[model samples]
Target: MDAGAAVLTALCGAESFSAAMATRPWARSPHFFVHYVPVENHQTVLTSPAHTALSTKLSTELPTDSSLESLGVQKLGMVVPKRHARRAVTRVLLRRQIRAAMAQHRCELLPGIWVVRLRAPVDRQAFVSASSESLRIAVKAEVATLLGDVLRRCRSTRHAAQAHAQPAFQQPSTVLSAP
Candidate 1:
């Protein structure tokens, strides 16, 4: 199923921000699903007793660098319920919406690990209060724009490197044969 339609499966199963911080290569962009994994406790969060329980299960379900090779896109999934409704059902729906949004633009997006972190609460009541279809669309557009920006940066860097390396010269005219 497309990631968008497969919202339930995708959001619930995405790799956590903390996990990606430890195991994946990350680039900062304004469009991120931020969390509060402290710099000091990062190691403990990944290895702590309670976190470990979730990690072990997550390791199997979440995509690693090698696994993403098949999809040609990198993605991270996480559900962060707002402190008020941290464990609510509305959070799941938000995640699902995100997945759906990601799936819709999967083609234009770059192939690399993309993290989908959820910061809003998913409690039914919470979602009812704050969720909207447009919010999901806006987030998706922002993410895609961010990814595009990254791609542009990479291209520009490579171009700069190439420009520095090349010797200045103009190509000679080529002879053409007409049949």
Candidate 2:
């Protein structure tokens, strides 16, 4: 893999994802756990459950850059008990689907991390009967919707901040020197 990909893999690795989530901001879905961490130059997205028990302290650091282009998405899945090998395979498939969705909607994102976690009780039958294609489509649609919402909010807030930061201009007064 290339450097960017390698770096991503290392940063968002299963163990690291769990560790980061312990201290970062996160969102959730019925079958997912999501964590986000904004960093300089790039954002880190971590998805994990196996290392959920791990903990980390939150940092107050802000990213150096503030654009939507430096964002990334990490998709993670958990291996369900009893399914053994099938559990592993199913989770990999799920990750691939989520990645595809992220690729399609990446442009709408801002400079931040996005993590997705899929949770559930599982059995051998669940993996064997799962429809990966359908899952991919659903995830992509949701991702697109989320990106739009986030971008909209960011723009509005940015405008408000700029308005508040600038001082209002005063008109110059002209004095007449009539004798």
Candidate 3:
């Protein structure tokens, strides 16, 4: 793994993907689905179960090393199901592409658990060889597109939040708080 990917913790254990976390996908590409959810603050992880007991369970069930939930960095995981890729070589190729793509966009992504799941298979006839250069390039391009969209969405959401947080037509803080 490269330095960029080394910094990223990989999500493992079934509990990490349980209902408590990443219940829904945040974005999608032609053959992939991206799921991003902020890991709950450790101090308050079990304080409130937003919907059910699963929230409390999440903390204990998740494996320690693989899940860097409390840290302010991206934790990644990929699901290239056998059903989708079929061949071991194809699955491995897809996984490498996903990791490379994530490493490329890690700096821009929000600190959270990010999963890239293979939802559909590529057209086998189009690229007969399982792990051809064309296939790798195609997967890389699709993943790049997926991450790009996620970045845009995160930026827009952040902007909207900043806009909401500031009061309209407010005097400068220096003047307003003058002694």
Candidate 4:
């Protein structure tokens, strides 16, 4: 897959971050949870120069269309709380795993702002070291599952919204001719 196609904006700024947090979460597991909110206009929400650079790069690689324009760009944010992973190394490792797993499912995800927040710590007894390969593998699996659930939920929600937006029935027009 093209790097540009897989690239995702990292959500910044307090307003956008808070907005993502306020949205209902799509999935949750022992270690992490996901929150996402659809963005109607990427330009308005993504004001940073980095976002512009990424958008231009993506646009050049992909064909332009109304759907593509409306889809715009997808943004991601990660929150590895210290309470969940006390060691900085562990937090960094988890963050990297989250990014990689999300990248794999980028195509399935709708254009929106998504945030993955760490909720619990991995048991130390399971893996002796923070850098243990086993721990990395476990983290990757968990992240993949979390993202998969979120994507499923997103699709269902979108379908529901579309169903509601369509008119149930149309009224027939009545005409009277001169008697």
lDDT of 2 by residue, 1-179 (tens): 12243112223355445544555334444444545444432333322333233435233434333222333432222322333324555556556655665555444433344555555443445334454555556545654554455456556755786789987887889999999
Q: Against the true structure, what is each candidate's TM-score?
A: 0.41, 0.46, 0.73, 0.69
Superpose all Cα atoms of candidate 2 onto the true structure and report the RMSD in Å to 1 decimal. 9.2
State, as a TM-score between 0 and 1, how close model 4 is to the true structure: 0.69
lDDT tens digits, residue span 96-170, model 4: 998888877776677778889887877878877978899898998888788878878867977897889997787
Candidate 3, residues 3-37: lDDT per residue as tens digits?
A: 45435667655655553244577888889988776
lDDT: which candidate is best?
4
User: For model 1, how does the per-residue alpha-carbon lDDT over 93-154 read when each residue is reduced to its tens digit?
Assistant: 45565566556655444433455554333344423445567545655566566555545654
* Candidate 4 lDDT (Cα, 0 to 1): 0.74
Scored by lDDT, model 1 comes in at 0.46
* Candidate 2 lDDT score at position 161: 65
Weakest lDDT window of 10 consecutive positions for candidate 1: 5-14
- What count of clashes does model 2 give? 5
Colliding residue pairs in candidate 4:
none
RMSD of each: 10.0, 9.2, 6.4, 7.9
Error of 2 at 112 (Å): 3.8
- State residue 51's C-alpha deviation in candidate 3, in Å: 19
Pairs of residues at least 3 apart in sequence or in different chains that clash in candidate 3: none
